[model samples]
Target: MAHESTDTASENGPELQRALSNRHIQLLAIGGAIGTGLFMGSGKTISVAGPSVILVYMVIGFMLYFVMRAMGELLLSRSSYRNFSDFAGDILGPWAAFFTGWTYWFCWIVTGVADVIVIASVYVTFWLPLIPTWIPALVVIAALIALNLPSVRGFGETEFWFALIKIAAIVLLIVIGLVMVFTGFEHDGARASFLNLFNVGGGFFGGGLMGFIMGFQIAVFAFVGIELVGTAAAETKNPEHNLPRAVNAIPVRVLLFYVGSLAVLMSVVPWDRFDADNSPFVMLFSLAGLGAAAHIVNMVVLTSAMSSANSGIYSTSRMVFGLSTDGNAPKAFSKLTRRQVPRNALFLSGVVLLSAIVLLVFGLGESKGFTIVTTISSLCFIFVWSIILISYIVYRRRRPQAHDESIFKVPGGTFMPWVVLAFFVFLLWAFTQDPDTLMGMYATPIWFALVGLGYLLLRKNPKHQQLRRDHEERIAQEKREAAAYLAAAGSRKVR
Candidate 1:
């Protein structure tokens, strides 16, 4: 019904089309959630957490599954709400929308920036070792902008293929790992068996308190884009039906790709043998005796990192488009192209994304620069996910009837939010443990301060006031329509 209204083409401009199909939505969620964190960064994660990282992945996965469920329910409850920020604004206030929308935008902007740097730096080692690193970075930015500019479906297609490749790689690794395990494969004197998990090390908690704490610090980031599906709900076909499926698959993904892969890696190669500098994926493949193992792994991670940057551009553009429509950003950003794409928003994001090239030029080196950017980015994502959880709590309290009647409800209900909230607190404490992560914690306040300053300045602007009023009016109108629909249903039942 909301799509029916926006698709009619009013003065405000055409709505974001429902171009993402079920498969597209599912893979987009998978693609967004699984990135360099698992592919490239997992090597470091395993080096830091050892076998305990497996539990870290599982625990984070368990908590965030409910977070996704809560998000899935909220998006389905109101079609008029374009994203979590919109519903957050509607349910919490305009201020919540302003904060969440812009924070979400900034979150991806930082991530996109970091991703491009990674793209360029990784290029030097692999495909274009002879080419200038910045060249590939520029080419990737330009190419993704082209893919995104055409239509939502075009972006979906690109992401679909990207996700497919990652999935195929993961599945292949798992299958090979299984073969090695069954045949008692030995590589470089390390025997392939499940017992290697505890036998070869100081046991499953191989990493002591410090290692365990850092595990949360590192592993939390891998789950950063887990909620990306919520952002795409507006452009998804039958979101009410498709979104839940996407969200539900997160646990399975975590278990198979993360927990399963790590389980096999540690089993095949001793966790202590895992180098912080190398990919566990590459090492595993090389151990399994792929002659071109280095090249294959390099290409897989290259494509994976590129896919992540592409997702950042796509998500950031949409978020800016949402923010603009909400009157929190420039009106130009809300303007759509003939294909219903947000050309202005896409450009704004791309220009900002180009800043990543500066990191390449300045040469903080990808290792150090990526850590700094991703740390801040991860903290920002924690803030965003917390808002979604808080919004869910508010939704349950204010709209009990709506929650009661929903076809797709979060299974744990009121209790899980508290449990997840505690997990977040522990995670924040975990961030305090390492100097690098602690530095990120300290850096986070500057962003909030800047946003607060912006909010204060925008508060007095007539344009912002008008946007606020428009958003409230839209929410009010949806309430009226929902009431009428229910009334008609009641009448039909009486007859």
Candidate 2:
């Protein structure tokens, strides 16, 4: 209930330092774009969609690219904007910020839950074998919070190494898979050839319509963290250059990491042979006569999940800070530690993550409840993406001059949002094709309704109203000063 603070330093200053560099931004972008979804989830994608999973990854990448561009342009439009929530609030409304900010927070929280729980299982099964999974899950959650509590650079460095491992794994897979394919290497009496892709069981579209549709459900999860680049805009020095570079490289990365890896993987190990429950990378390594493949792949998967959970803590804490700054959340969330990280928000986020461990304790998680939770998380992300596109459209309509002035412009400005939106609609329809995804879509409304109710409640608070009024007034004042300065400069030039 208490909103005001004697500590107004952050309110009047640039609270977060720009400690992330080009390399940090690049690797973080890669880490955010790639997840355990590629390493651990692709087997199911290959098994269910057959070779058509290639197209599924391509399509998802294509659509999400526009979303990232729109986000990049939006973030670049204003210097003071910390994340999408700031621009959303200024252009769309406080309500947009309230919803999008919280929804994004919800997104990473859900994702982190799924990641930590899986990491816990991996620990218990592979290393501890005799210990309870919940213990490991708790340990992971605590460790992420500790790692993140230090500084933003720590988070960046952590992701740098994590992303490096993923890149190494993919490169290794592609190199080895290509060699086997070209040499016609035989594994378990099955020749590793390009023909292995379509020659086994069913051809290219082996799974047919339903199979391809199912790919979207799993493949979408691979892209859940891609937009995390937007959240980094404020922390990256020279965001104009760094941010666009990160967003633009996504398609190429998708091609290499998703399409390339999967193509080579199925070539090495036939799609039919890929276990939906296991990592194809490990399988190929084992077949390549590497006895330590399982252990190595297990380490990669654990690191991949740890990277995701770490990102969740970083993202959710920032989002909560945004919400709190906008008077949409508790003021405690805005408290920044000496290190400039949102310590209180991070603490609260980790505290809530215990629910993930709880879910695992009750016979959920790993593959069973994980599928459902991730589906719902995917649904939340789709909503957040839609809001960004919609916000971009509004920005163009209401402030075309701002778009004209933007340095890193989103190509096909006016028409692209519609294209992205339509693609999203198609994806939603695709979700309807499967029971699990359909349930996720159905559950979305309830989440939004709850958020809307919270918005209404927050709007009623006197302090919230005052903050909104002051925020609008501040914008108006800045606009007037800019216009007057431009007019005086023009007159002086004419004289």
Candidate 3:
């Protein structure tokens, strides 16, 4: 059976043990998927497609459901599949593993930077009204690094409560919005009608074809961390059971939290008034005559940003650790502290997050930082998704029997992968259509080119080459030994 192999002599620490429980896995999955992007960006999506934004979210959710299912089937096939990167290596090639691991690491780093920028802005709005935004950004980075250095469960617990707050806030907003829809308390005495879905629109596709298409840009952001559940497989108490449940529930949770909430927002307020500058949740409460609504929403958004940053720290560390194990990163990264956490990797990720603070301080403003980081992260997500599809294609071709045995398969398997690939291409095209996103879209290819160059350099490293040969020799020797053992046993039985 495939299982994680520990370097016993390399690190003798309390942290090297798996300590996370099923509850931690469940909540971490929730926290990972629910980020500030959904909380703050949903209004912009609504502005784009008006009421049809709901459909955009639902469609994206449906497609991502299949993606998660694919991941689940792959992970469950072998106890040795530590994470997606391992699966990528097994199914695709060593190079695929190197690319997937590093790409994912970079993705989290970029997303963490975005979260830092946003979190700094939120803090600036309250305590440090006159302080330069970068100060708070640096402080937030330092604090998160401190938190993560302790233990994995510490990170998990923090994220659990952070996610719980956001979940509770959304539940409250949904309940209140429903009441407003039914009771007509804040509707200016107009009867609540289901017709609101179509009544306030310039038709359902509110911004026309352009708007409908543009909705994917925002819709995809909400699904950015959906794959995070797969990362927790290594730490989960019972991955075979917990993973399936978490994977299956992604679609339903996304529908309830995204589509359901948007439906209420449109019913209570005209979709046109769903401002991009402020949260729709605050708008709902403000319209309902609550004076403290803005502050309340700000608190929720704060937690959302923290949640994203927290997840970034956790996922990036694991990615780096995976890379280290594969000889694609510095060996020191795989070193764990007493808590079984990759302390070196965690510190490195935190250090990278400081770039966000620097961007806020010396380069762009906070808003610009958010834009740049988010765009880069989104592009990285596309890269990761593409790797998964490529890996799955290879897995199916190489192990036809194993592929046939998967209980949970990606629906429409071969065709759907192509369709999703095309959809991502369209999203890239749409990114270029807008002036704001065009530069970021162009920057993405440059980023990949840099990664490719790095891979070439790593490939040439003597140490890495030796490690690769060693790993191959080890596998071949193991196979030969197994065959010999079986032959000897058969001869004895014949005698």
lDDT of each: 0.82, 0.83, 0.76
lDDT of 3 by residue, 439-464 (tens): 68877788778878988899888865
**lDDT top scorer:** 2
Q: What would the per-residue lDDT of candidate 2 be over residues 76-121, giving only the tens digit for each residue?
A: 8767778888777776667888899999998899888888877877
On TM-score, the candidate that comes out on top is: 1
Candidate 3: which stretches are off by over 4 Å? 1-16, 186-192, 367-369, 462-495
> TM-score for every candidate vs. truth?
0.92, 0.91, 0.89
**Model 1 lDDT-worst window of ten:** 1-10
| 1 or 3, greater by TM-score | 1
lDDT of 1: 0.82
Clashing pairs in 3: 2-79, 2-80, 14-338, 15-338, 15-339, 15-340, 16-340
Model 1: per-residue lDDT, tens digit, 1-495? 223223112346548888999999999888876877887778888888789899989999999998888888888877776788877877776778788988998898888887777777874447667777777778888998999999999989998998889888889898898899889998778789999889876878887768877988888888788888888887999887899889888888889889998898888888888888888888888878898888887777777877887888888888888888767888888888877899999998899888877767777645654676788998899888889899999778756567767878999888998899889999989888877888888998999999899998987899668756766676676567667766776898999
lDDT of 3: 0.76
Clashing pairs in 2: none
